[model samples]
Target: MKQRLNLNLVISMSCYSSLYKPSLFHTTTNADIKAYLVGKLQTCKDLTSATLTHSKAIISGLSYDTFTTNHLINCYLRLLRIDHAHKLFDQMSQRNVVSWTSLMAGYVSHGQPIVALRLFHQMQASLVLPNEFTFATLINACSILANIDIGRRFHALIEIMGFGCNLVVCSSLIDMYGKCNLVDEARLIFDSMCIRNVVSWTSMITTYAQNAIGHYALQLFREFNHLRLDKPNHFMLCSVISACASLGKLGSGKITHGVVIRRGHDANDVIATTLVDMYAKCGCVHYSTKVFRRIQNPSVIPYTSMIVGAAKYGLGTLSLQLFEEMVDRRIKPNDVTFVGALHACSHSGLVDKGLEILDSMNVKYGVMPDAKHYTCIADMLGRVGRIEEAYQLAKSVQVERDGYALLWGTLLSASRLHGRVDIAVEASKRLIESNQQVAGAYVTLSNTYALAGDWENAHNLRSEMKRTGIQKEPGSSWIEIKESTYLFHAGDISNCNQRSEMLSLLRELEERMKEKGYVGGTTGVVFLDVEEEAKVEIMSLHSEKLALAFGLINTPKGVTIRIMKNLRMCRDCHETFKLISDIVERDFIVRDVNRFHHFNNGLCTCGDFW
Candidate 1:
């Protein structure tokens, strides 16, 4: 019998061998060397004659160059073998910043941002000088974690390293600050940049869009076109679409769709999803549906966006239809997709459907209910007067104890809606005790107490907040006018241009609202033992009214007014905006901390659910 040596066995033996003596493997071509010694490299198992030319480079005595290490890291990451990747990286005799950065990237890519940050700090402690890639990975992790302090320190380090002008690092910094909710800082960085590439422009635009600075994003997009040596790509068009969605600038959004079509990005799934979101948010339900159907093969993201849009606009049935269609297509839904779907059911008061879907989350899809999912369910239940069940469900959730703020806030607000003062007081206590630092919880709890005639308890809660050094956040709103944004807080008299005129206009709007049966909503004066007039004055000067008045006076007649609030819009303001829209015969869109509210012809999109 002829003894036939198995080539694969020999290669596996060689690949898995520990290189005790590096010299034994020195003779192999780099193309013939194996970088990692696992059972069988997936790359090798599928190897063809064509890969033979490059095989020697991967074997032992292989130049374990940084490029080779990066390739190995890529393979392991693709295989979801992060542990092996880390082990390989640790065993390397010579390691550079690239090796460290690649490992950090693996951690980030695997959604372990904290691990990535840890490695970054370790690399720093080891005195390994980092490069642009390392800083970018670290900054990206900081962005997701929203560790502003860490991000700022990294920013200073980048400047120290003289890498601030590096385009890649600059783009990452802009993205970091943007995602960290520091949009102004991001813009500052963008403006100071000596060079701006497509990535830089995209990051800035998307930052503005994400921050709901839609008009500014559009302005930047126009500037981008004017300065461009190249036509707009899919990413740029997507950002513009998102900005349009944020602002409810549907006319402009449609125009951008035309641009996208011209640029041949209209069929792109990401662009299509953004377009659907824009149309839906702009109150153009028909166009939104049309855009949803135009995508021949929609992905989960677009489907989710469409579902969310439909739900937000009160097209609950349409949203359910899309959800069913998504399931039929066997497309897996992510957490965000479920939020939209469940939110739609909540909006439509489809209690049975909502409960069924919530159960199926774990039973069929293998995804357990997280805080956001539970919050949505609670919000839906609370909206429809299922207060006790909502409270029980909230109490049952163990993870995300901080979510009690949102859950109890919802419960308290619902109690106020239905005159369930007893439950409101109970939930309020839970809320304040759970997270006194959350301003919204304080506001909700206080309002609940006021509704129940328990002003003393409400006052005590407010006093506790103050004593604990938890300052109530000012009611703040943003208005974009003529390509510039102006922020207004309660009682703001900060306008240099036509200050007296703006103040007078606000006073007039308040009087007009009063004449239309809108009261001052003095319930917000939980801490005040004085007359209601002072509280009324305070309510009149609220940031939403100020911003709305500014937009009214500054913008063209019949143009819609858009405002973004840092907190939930007060009940009085939500009602007042309804009256104001009817009075001015114009549309209004307010994105608050919780959700979007659109007012047109004295009707709110929320239908008073929020």
Candidate 2:
């Protein structure tokens, strides 16, 4: 097709012998010139920069009608030369709605959504009423800004102009609301829509997934499937697979993968990458690797996903190997790739390697360290008992207040782990001064006091937290079995039917763990003046342990148990999981808030580093 277009372009340019003679060009009709230019603009590939430049030279001397000018503007926009398009738009003697919309769309395409919005207001002030496309573009701008107020205003105008029912406008509104973190509002608009298309459905699915309502997204996808109004496309499948990954639903993800295969989209790069991510997040690294290897000449997305997945599973060596391979293949590492590599290093206790990567990121890859990158480096340093170095690094780096607070919090956690009370105090003070409402700082400080045998100070801190109306977030864990997920909170006994059995199994495991020299660590329990036995009991009822016990009772002996936690695993729980894995001879994979911990034969992949 491109060859044919190029041949036509050459033929058309040759026929324009009048280019050398203005008198002959003046004889040509405006309508005929406009028709020819518009055809070329529509057919020529945007990446063919040389051809576009030649076309631009040819059109420079010709008189253009509004129709031809609009085509030229659109052509420049498609080529991502927004400056050229804007200049052309400004030089036009007369403008119409098409002219204004063309420039606005150009701004939006060029990642200047704010500029696009400003131009939209200017167009409205000029009394050139926006068409449906104009409204759609403005709504998308609102979505990018994530401004709910502006989006509502656009929605009002859309309804006032009777374009609320237009499929494109409605879809944009849904997307805008979703990006604003108003998924309920997005859903309301979706439900109210009288007409829907594939794009609309996909937008709503993506909205739910983006808002962390993955289960709802999957449910909506199921409803869309039941309707059978349209077949699922690659975009829809990708969104659904992402939702499954978020919920760690391996069964549903596999079903979706099967659908992708049946639809012959398994080879598509995007779908393949999504599949790899889904399987990896679901604790099936083998399957993720299998999907990744099937792609021929895989791009950075799949490679980065695989690296991050390996890191999540505590396969740091494997992640590093993949990074080296990617470099050997001459696929330049992006910021995300470096992040995965550093994360893998941190999880595996490769502090020196992580530092080297951090130092070379800007020099070797031309990727500067962002806040996330710095945080990974701080975590790596802190993991290996280098709290002072981590703290100094955090202080030296220029980051936003939130990033600084996060770094301090990590330092505090490391101090607590390594019994560095002085450093913990310093980090806690800095964190509190920066952000008074950070509940983690208060909790960690109180725990630090408890660990130091200062029960009175710990109690006072707890009282202070109550007085300040600050409450720490509750820990929760979930496990999936037979396509169903069961959630448990810390010390929760809500499941009356299974609570007794779970508790009995936990007790049996506790005895076995005790026999294997697994003594409970009481530092995690913050209660003052608690007996040692009571503290052990309290620690045994942690959410992850409950999930683990449930998995042990229900799953076959040989099957691996996977648990996902909403917070960092406590020391007691981590040790217990290691012992349990050895006793039951079943591998345990726990995905905490930070990273993955694989327990096997009384050992963890983190090597007691995390």
The local distance difference test score of each candidate is 0.64, 0.69
Q: Model 1: per-residue lDDT, tens digit, 160-269?
A: 98888888888988988888768899999999998888889999988887775776788988998898656778988888887877665656787899998888887788
Error of 1 at 513 (Å): 18
Best by lDDT: 2
| Tens-digit per-residue lDDT, 376-490, candidate 2 | 7877776677878877887788977656665677777777756678887888898888874267777677767776777667667777877778876544456554544556543
In candidate 2, where is summed lDDT lowest over 10 consecutive residues?
596-605
Q: What is the lDDT of candidate 1?
A: 0.64
Ten-residue region with minimum lDDT total, candidate 1: 598-607
Candidate number with greatest TM-score: 2
